[model samples]
Every structure is written in C-alpha cells, then in structure tokens.
Target: MQDPVVEYINRHPNAGWKADMNSRFSNYTVGQFKHLLGVLPTPKNVIEDVPVRAYPKGLKLPKQFDARKAWPQCSSVQDILDQGHCGSCWAFGAAEALSDRFCIHYNVNVTLSENDLVACCGFQCGDGCEGGYPLAAWQYFISSGVVTAECDPYFDDAGCQHPGCEPLYPTPQCQKQCKDLNQNWVDSKRYSATAYRIASKPYDIMTEVFTNGPVEVSFSVFEDFAHYKSGVYKYIKGDYMGGHAVKLIGWGTSDDGVDYWLVANSWNRSWGEDGLFKIARGTNECGIEEDVVAGMPSTKNLVVDSAVAAEQRASW
Candidate 1:
C-alpha cells in the first residue's frame, strides 16, 4: 500500500509532489496512511468581539454568525480539491487570506493561486496541510508576490491544465520566485485576532472590513460542507473534520428568513448556485461569531490616480 501522497503523485504525471506528514499542519488530525481524519472540536465559547459593532452601517449579516466588519473585503470562498482527501486546511486558510489581500492591494478581482502556495510554502511552515499560521503566510507574500489564480488553480487528483497559465510571475524558471519588496505590505494587511476576541457591541466587522474591500480569512467547515448540496444549509454532520480555504467577499441574507452569510465559494458555479453558498451563520464552524481573522489592507500611502484623487476630494 503506497502512501496517500505517493499514491497521488504516482497517478499524476506532471505535478511536483512534496509531502511531509510529520510537519505541523492545520487543525485536522491524520491517522496512519490516510486511514482516518479528525478535527479539533469547537473550543468553549470564549468572549470574543461580536461581529455587529464592527459592521458598517446598512450592511446585512447572518443572524447567528458574528464578525461582520472585522477585516477588509475579500474576493470569495473557493473550494479547491482537498487532494486525495488530505486535510491541509491551514495552507488553504493562509492562501485564501493572501488571495483577497493581493486583489485589494492591486485592485484586481481575480482568483489567487492557492495550489502554488500549497506546493511551494512547505519547509517554512508545516507540510501536507496539517498546520500553519496566517501570520507566517503573510510574511511569505511580502517576500514573494503570488501568481494570479488564473495561472494556477488547485488541481484535484485528476490534475489541471489551464492554458496560458504558468505558476511563476513572469519567467518559467522563476515560477514561485516572488519579487522582493518592502515588508510594509505585511503591516498594512495584518489582521488582529484579539480585536475580534474582545468586542462588546454588535459590530459587523466583516462589513467594515469590506467597506474598504474584500479580505480573506480561514475557518473549519465541520462536516457541514460535505453534505451541502444546495439552497441554505443548516444541518451538518460530525463525522468529517477539515479546514477549507474560502474567500469572504460580501454578506447578505436571503428572503427565506434563514439568515445567511453570503460567501463566494470556489467549487465552480456548479457546486453551489454559481459557486455561492449560505452557511447557517454561527452554527457551522463553531458559530461564525468567534472565527474572525482580518486581512488588514495596506496602510501605505494610498497611491491614488492624480485625476481620481483630486476629483474625489472636490466632492467631499
């Protein structure tokens, strides 16, 4: 019996297979040889910042969920193949966080290359997607600007071949070799967990964060996402445990009265109504109230187009 990683690599022809099960990955617990997967039970509800106070005025949020405006806006939640059923939520979380910030910082609304991060950012952090830190992933982006999601998408065991897509920024040989830039980007996009953990008001931090633009954050999907076959999911299973990489672009509730957190999922439009899903707010992922992490936008002097900046100020 070949190892899951090796077995996956064997079936695939071109993917650069790199795996280290021993490395500290995300929240999932892996048994011997992909036998069984485990997830960390939702920790006791610690007093964290409510998502209402942070929310920008007029922005609608899920009823049960919290953290409305905790961080900046992000793109959408994308579902990448878990890859041979490997639990590497930590890597996906980091990639998702960076993807949204990358788009906002550059003002581009394209998907980010999470696969590249999974394949490349190994030695620096845990390997095989078992565990990782959002902070460390941000640092890597500073040192290396990731490629557009168009260049590389997470391939399932079947593999991918999107045309004109290359993992590197410009050069083929230099793929994954990011441009060295000032680390200031890190400070600007940094999100603080403590802030969300200590808020009192019903602040919609997610709304406030998106007021500027979409930002990325990670969360555990409890077994709920697995059975999520369509319109407004509330019931979830306890057998599955995994960390999924998703983007949170905007929020809204449906007319059904089942308050939902409008999130853009990456499972391709086919999975959930145009790749969009409505999680039962706080129910999934230990009540969205506590799962707040911000991808702080860059605070560097806003480089406004001279024409646009002047006109905007005149109106003000």
Candidate 2:
C-alpha cells in the first residue's frame, strides 16, 4: 500500500525534502508514534528574562554551520539518542543539550542522566513520559541536579523491546540511590550553574549555539513528520499530532535555497535522515525558534572530592 505522507511529498518535487515509508515509523501506528511527542508548553517564567546574550551587532552567521563539526570533542552532540516508545523527549532534549554544554564548556565528556529528569522531576515538570515542559526540565537541572548515566541511565528502553508500540509507558519510579551500589547518588548528581531561554530572534539563538553548544527546542509535530526522509523539512501536510522536543545543533541553507535549522531527533539513527533533520529556519515554522532552552553546566559538580567519596564509602 502507498503511504499518503510519502505519496503527497513525492508529488511535489520541489518540496526541498523527500518522504518514504521505509523508516522507523513504517510500522508504527499513528497512536504509537505519538508517544515520542512529549513537550508541553511551559508557562512564562523568569527564565525568559535571562537571555543567552543580546544579538551582537554586525555578527555574521555562516551560511552553513553544524555543531558536530565545531565541537568534534563533544560526543553527545554527535550521538543520536533514542527516546524509545516513551514520550520523554522533553527530558531527553534537556538532558542531551546539557550534556553537550557540559562538554563544550569544560572540555570533558559527561553524559548526564535523562532518567533523573524523566522519573524524578515532579508535577511541576508535567506528567513525565506522557508529556513534560522543557523549561521545567532545565529548572530541575539546577534545583535537584541530574546524575551521570552510570548512576541512572535510561530505563525506558528496556521496557520497549518490540518493534511495534506498546501502551503509553508510565514514568519510572525515582531512584534516589545509584544503580551501582558503589556510586554515591548525591555526589554523582551533575548540577547546572545556570539555565535560561534564548531570545526568540533567529540570530540570538544562532549566537547561543555558535558560542556554546546545542540547545533543546520544542515544536509542533505534524503527521507528515513521521515520514520525513531527507532535505529540509517544512510542514508540507498532516494533522497536528502534538508538541515534540529535539536538540538544535546548528543552522544552514539547503541546496534548494531553503534556510533550515540543523536538529538532532531522539528517534534513533534508523529514522529521519540518520536521526537528524533540517527544519525551516528563522520562520519558526513549527514553533521551534520560540522555545530554545540551554545552560552552562557546572563541571565542578561532576567531580566527587575524596572526602565526600570516603564519607559515602563509609556510610555504605
């Protein structure tokens, strides 16, 4: 059978992107695919007042920019994380971007725990895997702090072992202790020194990514998005599914003369152009430019002093 999303996209050759059913969503029912769209609108907060920076005067952004190229040292920016069948994109987006920022600022790679934010951030962050607010995840980063992957890791994947989708997964229980008995939960937590929303202007967001690292953005996901394959994605057609979150790494103009934002999705490498897609830029086509959130990770927190370590060891 022909996939309508792919068929419609193919009918228009100049759409600047292609579509096909041979994707991770090929067998996923619409209901099942919706599980990944997990970002909710965060209410106006003080975070917006703290802009990453005022858009600099005469600042020229390159026509082609990609974060992976700029920060080869940062492995998080390069890796495409999977959200599995869980709607924890909100947590994944924030966690992954902060992980990238930690490496960018400190020159050391540390994979912070998305599990901490997903399972731990309470009602203020929204309903966890069902859906969550991006800003709240950031607030949790500073307030409660997130542990390293070794301490928690992502547990949602283990529950989604089949190719077909299962019922909506509930948020896992918060684990105050590390998975490994030897690790101290408190000391393993990584804190962010600061987190804030970037100004909604195109260049301001660009400067934020250029100077620091990747940022997390939530956007309106349409039905057509599930079938995207290559080129720059613009909402060509489809019913509104829900709000979705992803990592924004860079921006560039595609060969079709369409300007696009380079984004990394958490749907795994087998999906959507190797887990990365370029969406229409500057226009906020999917409300992407409006909700960029990132922060300066406190590398100091990643270090566990010998005194604290000894105390934890003795207590254990």
Candidate 3:
C-alpha cells in the first residue's frame, strides 16, 4: 500500500504538504502542524563576536548584476528544512538578509541570529513560524537596534541554546504605540540622502540595499517544510506554503547557468545541498527586488540610461 503520508502529500495540490522527513513528518496531522507552530527551539544560538561599524562610504556596484553574476558566486540559499519546526519564513527572510548584508558590509561571513528576530519581532510584525512580513520586520530591526545573539535563542529547543548563545550587541525591545506609519521610523539623515530615492525595484533590491547596509525581504516557504532532506526539489502537489522566511546576501548563477539570488537559510546546514539552493530570478521567491526598500546606492543612485529613464518617466 502507498505510504499514508506520501498519500497525503500526493493528495495535496502541488504536493506542498510533504515534510522534511517524508517518512516521519509525512504523517503529521493538522494538530501536529499547529503544535509545531507555537513551540520554540530550546537552546538559542549566539551571534559571532563582530563589531557593528558604520557602513563604508562610496562602495562600488558591479557593471550589471543579473542572473549571470548572482548564482554561483555572490550568494546562495539552501533550504533550512527544520530549524524551528515552525514555519516562520518571514523571520528567516529578515534574519538571513541581515546576516548577508552584515557580512558583506564587514567583508566577513557570519551567521546572524534568526531566533532573535522571530521571538522579539513577532509581537510587532512577524508570525511565530507561520509566516510574517519581511520589510516590516526590517523596520523593526532598524528601530530596535542590534539583536541578541542566537546563543540565547528565545524558544525552548536544543538548536540555539548553548553556552555562547547571547546577542553580541545591545538588543532593543519594540516600542509600544509606535507613531511611524508603515511602522517605520524616519531618519533625518537618511531622509536627506540620495539612496532613498532609488529603492524601487522589489527583486534584487535587497542585494542593492544591503550593499549599503542590511535590509529585509519576505516570502513564503511552507512547501519546503516536508521531506527537505533531498537536494533535488520537485514542487509538491497539494503542499500549500502560506509564506515563509529567508535572508538575501548577494546574487549568483547556478551550475546550470540559471540566475539565482543567494540567501542564508536557518534550517541548520543539513537540508538542501549543504544548505544552499538556487532559485529563479525575476520571480517573487528569490527575486530580491520584489520587496525593495530605500537608501542603497544600487537601489538609490542608478545612473540611468537617458533613453530608458525618459521612456519610464514619460508619464511624469
């Protein structure tokens, strides 16, 4: 007889219900999914000891960053199958982007704490593993200040809890009754900057904005929750992912010459191809430009070609 879990996944449209462990998680009932939703990981991971310094002024942009340059070299996103067993793709999206931007700004590769954002930012914007907003979360981080390290993760799980788990910088709690609409705080200095004007593209905008500093982007990843051990991913049948999270770093191309946005995933390093997966460009998921924000050179100060700019601004 066919496995019941496989049967359920098969019955699901696009096979979206397949769990990371097809054999184990495949049989998860709705109640189990709900239970996984609220439970937090035990041990929080710690942030690497790094100095939070001012962003370097006048960083250069590549001649033209596209799928050609984005996949194999600049960045990568592996499916973090079961970090929290919670489906909070929103938190992952913000945390990963910050990690990449932080690393790039400092020219160092370090993992930032996703649990910090998930636990603290949840009340203000993000959902507890069930999904949340990315841009709103970024605004939350910018206002809240440096997050606690992963070592003292907020949930109760073995993943993040460790002797070293603690925030490297001061972590700020959310302000009640915030006055900023769009839930964003305006910076007088940034308001006067040129980069603020160019943050319009929603796809690779994270890469652009992160080049100046860290920015967050959100998208859905619930379909990735099940049977994620395999490196080869085939879009499932009925598995309906109601939006998840991941972070954007840089762009690179896959071995297949396909353009992909590089992302950092929190699903431990075991899931997809050693925690790196390439996603299509120009579309929503890995398309970093889909959720563009302001104040980055690539995003803000594009030396637009006269013709293209004129064509676009004709309506003006």
Q: Residue-wise lDDT of candidate 1 within 1-316, one digit each (tens)? A: 2145434433444322222222112223333222112122323332222232353367664444322243324333233323333333444555565445434444434454555555555544334334444334444454444454455545433222245532122111224432333323322232212112212122453554444333334455543344343455543333335444444555545566554555554434444545555654434433444444444323233343566545433532
Best by lDDT: 2
| lDDT agreement of model 3 with the native | 0.40
Over the stretch 1-316, how does candidate 2's per-residue lDDT look in tens digits? 1387789998986678888885566556788778779887776663556645456668777888899999998898899988877889999999999989877766668888888888898787888888899888888888889998889989866547666645567788997889999999999988876778888888888888887789999999998888888989888888999999999999998766888999999988888888999899989898888888887776456664556545433531
Candidate 3 stretches greater than 4 Å from native: 1-82, 106-115, 126-130, 157-215, 222-236, 285-289, 292-316
**1-316: candidate 3 lDDT, tens digit per residue:** 1245445554556432233443434435644443333212211111122112233335555533433133322242222434544555555555555444433333333343455555566545535454445544545555553232333333534443356653121223433322323332222101001112123243335335434444444343344444454322344433443433454445545454545555445555654435544444455542334444322111111234556445433522
| Clash number for each model | 50, 0, 81
Local distance difference test, per candidate? 0.40, 0.83, 0.40
Among these predicted structures, which one has the highest TM-score? Answer: 2
Estimate the TM-score of every prediction. Answer: 0.52, 0.90, 0.50
